[model samples]
Target: MRALGSNQAADPPRYNATTDLLERNLVAGRAERPYLVREGRTWTYEEVVEATDAAGSGLLGLGLDVGDRVLVATRDRVEFVFAFWGAIKAGLVPVPVASGLSAADVHFLLSDSEARGAVCDGASASAVLPATRRSDVPCVLVGGSVSGEGALTWEEVCGRPASLRAAPTTEDDVALWLYTSGTTGLPKAAMHRHRHLRAAPSALSRQVIAMEPDDVVLSVSKMFFAYGLGNSVYLPAAAGAAVVVDDAPVVPGRVEGLLNRARPTLLFGVPAFFDGLSRLEEARLPDSIRMVISAGEALAEDLFARFRDRFGLPPLDGLGSTEALHHVTSNRPHDVLPGSAGRPLDGYEARVLDPDQQQVAEGESGELWIRGPTTFAGYWRRPELTARTYSGDWMRTGDLVRMVEGRLFCEGRLDDLVKLGGVWVAPGEIEEVLRGHPGVAEAAVVTSDDGSGVPVLVAFVRREPEWDGSDLPAELRRSCRRRLAAFKVPKSFEVVSELPRTPTGKLKRFVLREQPSTRP
Candidate 1:
């Protein structure tokens, strides 16, 4: 029996995101290479290393230590990166909050994470950090007035010596906490370890995106989101590729301008981003972008086909979560699928499970379960949620999915199903059919209770200019009916001038549902 399988198992890999993340690029004689570009300013790998060291030393000077959680809230991507790496180097866990979060939301995150310190940009100080009642927690302001506020300024933080002591850490050490997008409810912090940081980038940078050192990446997803964090930070760092930094909200015109300036080989965004860009009605694809990535929401089939028609390549629609640290499954450049999430990356296993947690048969839709090295350790301080979501080594992803021919297709959230006229209807199915209509640019479906409190389906849509709301709502309902079961057809369709979406491009369905009524 081949000596009983050699009588031993293989050892696990070792890595630390802090000390060793970008070091490979440095050691490979690429230290002098441009690692990042922003506002016409480029930083070499060596320069970033020095700044990271200085920032780490400054944080240490602020009296933070190992195991402390430091909340970093900043609009400056450069400053955010420095703080992120610096906190880890100082043996601290970095909590990166979205810059767009409301002050109350930011405060709740800080308080919930039990953070010992905060680093905020001066512009965001007023909104991100109020008068904290926790006197022990220091608020360090960057690009703002730090005087008398008891906050250390950016100038002071980077004033330390570049040659600073690097903290010793193990693969199991906590590196950072990414807050959930909160599309469902209040945001919760998802903690990831140093080793977890190394997993996704490996499969994504080297295998999926096939990152070349000369490749430039422009990501609309900010570092606060796991998708952004992996693409903007880990993917580039591990692959020795350069990235363009812009913390501004992703507008189509702005995105085009970024493309003209950055000349990136790869562009990253979410579903709504591509939808907005497609609405720009440009007949041609951006000249310089070789690839495009879409995540954060289901990539509608119509949007995908339209994008591919112009771009010459299908927009790689991937399904990732804050809990998984990034994309556990994604489309490969060679294996393009319009609306599918592609296959699981190396070192990850994915399955579809029914309500009973039993594995669903092929071609059946159910909740997605993923087991991977990149799976987050747990949600911070929510033991019950953690228990409900994680089973032993498997993490329960809230998104529902269907598998066909070894490809994974996201079907929106399992909870998004609507019971219409005593039958279950997937809003995603109706939305997909409606979006295929030439008159509809985008469509979002939500359920409202009927007279008896039986949930009824409603659609909020953004119509194409040609349609101009000229009886298009009726056409959309007809389209849904022709393609869907009677129960799946929306009871009502309202043409919203604009459908609400989060900054990261997730449709704000909860906001739509909270409306007094889903009506004209």
Candidate 2:
């Protein structure tokens, strides 16, 4: 949990005003206004300018040219911000790699991007080691000392003067490359331009978030991901607000303590953390919190309702992806449906299409396609994937959804739909029913086969604190049978302490499938 001030000054005539995205209002912003906070210290907008300038100048001193890819492997702390903006200011392409990437994934990114340099903290340092050993480059280290061959300390990265000009770059120049969340396989890098940063804050930040100058933004999701990058860096900077960064493991009690201490006005987290937080014992939200944003996965209706009842505000649920940059569809404060995914933000368009590629009706579920200024140019070095997924302005999202008379209802992924008794079933429907039960704290439904050719629906349940496993499985089964059709009911229920989850709180169904059967 470190606070890294990220403010810079205007570059020379070679640099256009737009190229210096962060330096747009360094002088205009209130000098004493807090721009960053960690633990007990705070950095003003003016102080951030010095730190940011120092980082950029230091990188330039390393003899790296413009457009050379620099790998940014750090957490949600100041070092991450410094390296990210520093490389951008120096007219270099910064690849913001995920913190939890494995050795193979790290090798793929470094080799694919052809990175010239790297900056990382303790968490990501180990992964970078093998990559550097194979490619031999300058590496800047943060947090703690690591015995490494190519590693340079953070102080070395900022050892230069506190004044440096941003490189002269056009709007279409490569700005950053965001690697996709690697739940499986080698992650693809989504290439974005210098101008792509504008659409996210304008549509999602202004129209949907309604971020104010006084707001203090806090995010449970780390900054490496596209969703976290927008809320943590883009939105907060655009609104002249402060950002709170914490790299610790996210838990209900730990999050509660941070909230009470920081008292952030805007809170952003995934559905998994929100569900747990809502069910915490004697949980009380901070008075300063005005909004809570849910994304990454579908937000369950039960968790949403319980959270709304506990806290006086309905969580602003939205849908976004690594390729889309940030949020595309979001719910506003005045208009929010309990289960619906809400409408797309201004400047973004969403169209649902059937298997034939023809458009579908508002209420009929179809594969989602989106087109907007925020969409990335394409995946790096993946022309076939790029061609298959993107066509002109529209990108096939691979998500199944229905507008349902103006409100969006996500019907899981296109592949998540399963066949049961000669009928197609969406796991969301059964999961929704299970979540409605008082004993259920969290639930997920997936199809599996037990050596018989026939596929059966299996339900995984995590019971709430108030209820033990006693009779809960039967109770949940009975509840689902009463509400849903007989064919849609789960074949068996497995009560467990927790479900398999990714680092970002997303469920890893592929991993769950490998576990031994708990069948009775």
Candidate 3:
């Protein structure tokens, strides 16, 4: 296991990610193998390469220069893949944003990225069109009528003969930009180099899953997210496996249908998605599925037991971030611990440290710091933040965790901790206890100020449909009293239809903290 700080050559010095991922298959005589399956259609490795080549040529012809930024706001489809690799092949930085963003949000991204052009599907064109127009950048429609003047359809741009030559990009050159979820504040762009794409597959996919060329993968997350990008694009390509792409929303019944149709050997989803699937009477894992990976947020122990009992395979919970390309630490297939995030991946190193930058004792919770080959170069245009986030090569993960018998157990994020009555409390501890109670489907804990401006804990719970709500709050309080300190107990329990989440299924805890507390 080699770390990035070591002076060794994991990848060649003059490497281009697009050229390497696509050309390797052809070199290995796998050009005819199926690489992408979407909506009943499949594309061979050869076909994908040609499409990406054409896409690169088309973008270069549009007066976009090398190193220019191109925003890709499209749904999870073949076209999104094409536009992404195409820009990278042309030596242009591709910034992929969520397809479902509002017009104003899209405009903000366009301006922040200073993108020279954009690619959008019909579903997202309404937002991207106005955003690109407002930003004065060229727009290319992927799969719909061109509604705006000067906007070109994908075919019109890439129909001509394309040059097979790829841009000269080194391993250290910026390949793409992934934006943070903005759970705490405004979104920040993390710049990843060409070599970073090769790191995750080697460490997590190859080592933990033992992924093989014959395996097929399916994910509920969209390509814009870092987790989804690894699952659908780079990881599969590196492993020489096939990926099933679905643009449909993640409904339990719909995912079940997709499972039956695709028969993927491995599935990737967030804990919330797995929880939803566990509730459906019609949901069952296809016999082909061998493992399930849970990410984007921590997986509760109760939900993990329920999923394992229902599906017969334990969900591998991992912790990763946009700063790292994908998972740096993850639970392996056969060595899973229900609530732990597992050990660091083969090529990554993790350490839990105190506020003074000294390593904490084992089993003592502290801030997590990780150093790995997949670490991002830095935040785009935010030098001060980047400086504060890194110490030499180690990147602060912003997560609070403890090491127990070689496994990493996450308590919560440092920013989410609530200081109640002069004692710091981890909300996850209270939420876990609340979730362990019967009929509690989901729980999120946030801080609310009491009448004297003292911070107090408030829990928002989503209960089972059949569970009686009469006196449930009092019962929940009693449950907490038995398991937690009095200060750690939530002062109020508010039952809601659903908790707020980001597009990628991450809890928007800030939204909960901002709402006026209904304290009694």
Candidate 4:
């Protein structure tokens, strides 16, 4: 078992993640330093500390006991930040879910987490109220319109004494629960400890990005995402740096607006957002951006080259998961492989193994397994599934990857591999080839059931605005034939306005697989 990064897992017996992230700034005389900048409003470290203190006290005053789970569903706003850290500060576990989920979806999370309390904005409240009503869970509403039978308004919560003492939590104590992106099935909550939060800063951010106190980070992902939570919240907090927050939809125009306004030193986004930025003619990346990190999905080599050609900087592609908390393997600033997820971070271990539980040779595809101090403890309330997911201390990441020269080239999900004519094919390879075509703006390949119930390859393509579909199907076929084997080429192509994606910007192949292909 070859491990790439250092092992620096030493920590104090008793630790509080929220306290470690926030109080250090004050102790270092950075009380007035900007912590969160949104629109024209800037919250200093002192201000955030005060607000989080009040929020913590408020949750405690609501009769919520220590170790209770609190569902935090809100946009990427200051209130969301306060509620999350505040819960941790008060010894409560915060389960942050995507705010864009439907009412029924939000309800599922509330019940699944067995939440004792919920903090939501108006939109999230609408999604949460019906469920909380049935469960009799206490609700605290923040920002925007507040309405619910027994829900406490943000103003009402803060009306109480605005002070709190950090909880006496051990390093191993559960600090938060992050739900997985349920692309394959229902989402499962990944339990993380206070110590896990402390490890990522040293492991990835500090060593890979060289994050410093004076830097400002702009993350296009919402705070609900594992990538966003690390990039926008804890990493910045741990570094005593500032984060730019916004609830705006991640369109190229809005992202450009943020880039021009925030002038962030670092920009964190997914491959889709990066692709969008590369397409927008007027999109401007400021000179202040020292690094751009891409994750959540595999970054294509063509997209990597196009982005580099358009902008002087190439995106440092990386791989991380909800189970891993933050980045496990990442491309460093100076040492980067465009299409590959670079070496393991400063304190993590990664390995590729075959189905027989033996290590695979270099350049051979296999399941990627990772183990680190910050790896999530277990799935909440699912012991059997957790047992199956872990092999000793190593967590099976479910990702298919090949290691070459210590860099990982991620193929796709293990479940996503399609077998056609007895040969298994990776959809990412076909999709990457399709994306290389000049007329194709975006592409996704999935196995769909034929009329006889046998699965066949179907490609869903979103054409560029200027493209005419007159000869695209034939052109695309030729493109695929030139680049891929006969068995790997998509059997049929379906031109669509948009490709289905999850809230986190991951392609929803399951959804695509279920939909029928219209074009032959």
Which ranges of candidate 4 are over 4 A from the true structure?
A: 1-12, 159-161
TM-score of 2: 0.92
- Model 3 spans > 4 angstroms off: 1-12, 159-161
Model 2: which residue pairs collide? 4-78, 7-49
What's the lDDT for residue 132 in model 4?
Answer: 80
* lDDT, residue 358, model 2: 92
**lDDT for each residue of candidate 1 in 54-135, tens digit (9 for 90 to 100):** 8877777777777678788776478788778777777778888766666777778777877778888754676665634334
Of models 2 and 4, which has the larger lDDT?
Answer: 4
| Residue pairs whose backbone atoms clash in candidate 4 | none
Q: Whole-model lDDT, candidate 2?
A: 0.79
Better TM-score candidate (1, 2)? 1
Clashes of each: 0, 2, 0, 0
Candidate 1 stretches with Cα past 4 Å from truth are: 1-15, 131-136, 282-287, 518-520
Residue range 1-520, candidate 4, lDDT tens digits: 1011112356536678888987788865688899999888999998998888988889888888778888988889998888888989998888999887887887788889888898888767777777788788888888755565878788788535488998867777888999998998999999988888978788778888889889999999889999999999999999989999888788987789879988999999999998899988877799999998999999988889989899888899999999999889998878988889898886788999999869999999999999898888888889999898899999999999999988999999998998888888988889889988889999989998889778889999999887766878789999999999988888899889998899899888889988987778
At residue 215, give the lDDT of candidate 3.
Answer: 89
Model 1 scores worst on lDDT over the 10 consecutive residues at: 1-10
- TM-score: model 1 vs. ground truth: 0.93
